[model samples]
Target: MDKCAILPIADLYIRVSTEEQADKGFSQRYQEEVLRRHCEVNSIQVGSVIYEDFSAKTFNRPQWTKLFKSYKVNKGNRPQVLLFTKWDRFSRNTAEAYATIRSLEALGIQPVATEQPLDITVPENQMTLAFYLTIPEVENARRSLNIKQGLRRAKKEGRCTGLAPVGYINRTTETGVKYIAPIEPCASIMKTAFEQIASKTHNITQAYIHATDNGFNKSKNCFWRAIRNPLYCGKVPIHATPHECEQYVQGTHEPIVSEILFFNVQSIINKKREQLPKRSNIEYLFPLRGFLTCKKCGEVLTGSGSQGRNKKYYYYHCHSNCKSHLRTDKLHHLFVEQLKSFKLSENYYPICLKILKRTLTEEAALKTKTTYHLTKKIDELNNKIKKARDLLLQGDIDGSDYKKIKAGSEVQINILCEKLSALQNKQRQLSKDVNTGLSLFSKLRQLYEEGDIHTKRELTRLIFPEYLVSDGKCFHASPVTGAVKRLYNKEHSFTGLFSYNLSIKKELLTQSDSLIIEQENYETLGLSQQNNVSTSEVNEVMSLINTLAKIITIQLLK
Candidate 1:
């Protein structure tokens, strides 16, 4: 064990944890200087100088590992001492640090902390060594606990901590308070993307392609994650803890998309609506391929051409072992005829048109009312919580009862917030939708009859959300969508104007008067109001109608 006098060469092990690097005296340079001066004062030789910029949470530092390897591999000319500024510099993990010290001592190398010297020979000094090692470990635990609690607090405050998401960038206020601000084209692009996805007209791929065209710079996987992130909709996900399940908090940051739109996209992504993408020209024969199913067996109808003597005849038939088949032409004609019921007669057209516009206006106003009431209720609930807190502070109520009240109020507020978000989102499109729905109902027959495969499939999807069953001559869209219910409700006669039903939900035939409209804001659709209705302009507005018809069809999908 004799390294000879003046030959106890010490390997200078200077360590500074990442978080401590900016501190006044915890720098690696400071540690090196102290160790070198200690060596100079003791006439000790300096061996290899090792510097580590890592955490002392473990003995896994790169430099430490390499030195430990050298100690084990090469016995000759090895350092006699492993000198650092403190025991924590050696390791914050007490057990690993003790093991490492024993290993060094086994190799005839004494581990010395220049700042906190210990005489291993003195039995009582072992307690002092434990004290020095344990303090840093306790410090690390406390620091971690504080960080977690701070992060949880930030989430509850609806603050976006750490790096801002794709559409947002982290910013600091003039006073250095942190916040998230919407970033450029990505923010606008993302907002449009959410609306597109929510509309169900554009699938995820189409939305991605549109975004890319509009300067969306993200990979497909990244785009998927971006759309799924609730942060875009102003919801922050709180991490799960032992006492509570993971929750979503309304964020303070501005939302690129509404909560309703975000959730709608989620549902679409979750199942893609089980709706097939628009077919190509090759699939023109079966425009309703995915939307039509066998009335008998409930299987999707398959389209195929029959080989005949002179020409091939196309037909939709059950692929299963069932005898259900219909000529493509006949089914197409029947569907067109079914849509004719949607078209109002020239005599009653204006009256029905007025009714439709009035209904849309009333629906919009009802939604606005619903949104207002939900918000008001939420405020009232919050005030109740505040009052309960005051009572608890004044010793009027026990903590347990106050907690129950707070929990119940919070749940109700969450539900109301969700409903409010949906109403608000729908309201944004309601004005445009009123026009779109009127145009769509204007000529359901012509649109379906002339539309290409894409348009035809979309039209079918709206008319029949799940699938329509055709029993030879007629197509039956049971559990009818609200739009279709107006066209074919059993109780309502097409002999009259298009007042099929107003139930709005399940019954679809109730004569209940629940809502009134703000007539000033809503204009008549004028389906046949204009004596000289420009055909071209109607077509133009009709084109704008587009997939936004989904607002009317949301009942079936929502």
Candidate 2:
């Protein structure tokens, strides 16, 4: 007999679901071994093993793709056979399984399962094959539905589900679901990150370093993601459905950050984006920003395209009919000199301290009002209980009436008790704020002075009320306090135009003094002013200056 006539061979296909991989011993390797033995006993040759590490929901699997390709390419070859561990392992959709089997038949390939009845391929075995394939697929679908239904019910009963975000760990008990405690290394890093960002002393990179120094090795993207996530503030995201994420539910979890710090970090990120530079192919004349507004008009002195002598150059022009143009280099040098003269008085700290004290007092009064409401509710509950008892003692209340009154009083008492507990917690948090506010302001100022481009931009938005340019003048408009107005204090204005102009003069004087000092002792003053800066060096300096100017303008406004 020819070898082809004597031997029957088959391709092995195995599959497993994610849930089955965890709970069952129905492994691909084991199924392949079992099928190998079956092939040997049936005097068959093993053609190939094609398996997929995926749920057999549809025929869109890698192994299936390979199988179809091989079947099509070997159109006139010896008969091909496909073998699987079981029916559902082959496919979980009944109509799809039937259609796929019919396609294999058309390609001169046979489908067989080691666990399926051998009579399935017989003409009279239609019912048996359908039972083997269709029944298991339906069972698989039903089981999946049941699992999801159970999970939904658990969530509705207030159970926490899904992976715990970095700062939290999900805990469940007979009482209810809660975010119990923090994971040590993760939680500590999270706390430090929040404090560092809140301090404003550190940029995103510096904050990442602080976290890494404390033994956290999370990715830079993860660090930013953690900062942006509201889950750190104790909110849980519960996805809507298994098939569709249409909505979310916030679970109760222990927070790792205060609401104020979270909002402040967000503010920093927003301002950084606003200040980020956009690349332009052609150089612009208004590159020296944050200073030198149109002298005639209040509009910003901005760069516009210009053509001269068959070459292109950018000019800083007042489009608002101020009608003046200045070279980019001259404007840059002038702006730098003007920036040096601005200074804050030593009384700035005292002014900030007084403001914080008054705010803390206002917060304390609010807490006291909340406490009063809780106490009032408690008194009302007591009165209701006494009246219910009086009615019962006088035999004027029915059983239902007594039960209703008792239930209402209990509910009221529970509500008041919860409110009282919440108020007490708020009081403690407010106390911490009061104690820390003074230190916070000092830290904030230091951060503003030392912060990188991004950090400074964030701080600027926090401090400055508005940014406006008009009539070649740039000045900050700070909110005038209600108390200051009551005392008839004039609105304070900090003008960048005067500050930059004086700063340039100061730089000139400092240079002159340095030159005189150098003349006295050539050896003592080793530094020498270089006549030329390299093109690359000049470009770097210009970029740095622009970034620094933006930071300063933001800070001065604050």
Steric clashes per prediction: 0, 12
Candidate 1's displacement at residue 274, Å, is 8.1
In candidate 1, where is summed lDDT lowest over 10 consecutive residues? 503-512
Instruction: Give the candidate number with the greatest TM-score.
Output: 1
Q: Write the per-residue lDDT of candidate 2 for residues 387-417, one digit (tens) a residue.
A: 9889998999965676667756764575567
lDDT of 1 at 303: 87
lDDT of each: 0.72, 0.58
In candidate 2, which residue ranges exceed 4 Å CA deviation?
2-5, 16-42, 51-53, 74-79, 118-128, 153-160, 168-180, 188-230, 241-253, 259-558
Candidate 2, which ten residues in sequence have the lowest lDDT sum? 513-522
TM-score of every model?
0.57, 0.45
TM-score of 1: 0.57
Whole-model lDDT, model 2: 0.58
Tens digit per residue, CA lDDT, model 1, 176-287: 8899989998899999888767766576777786687578878988999899888998888886675665678889899988776787678788994488467342365577
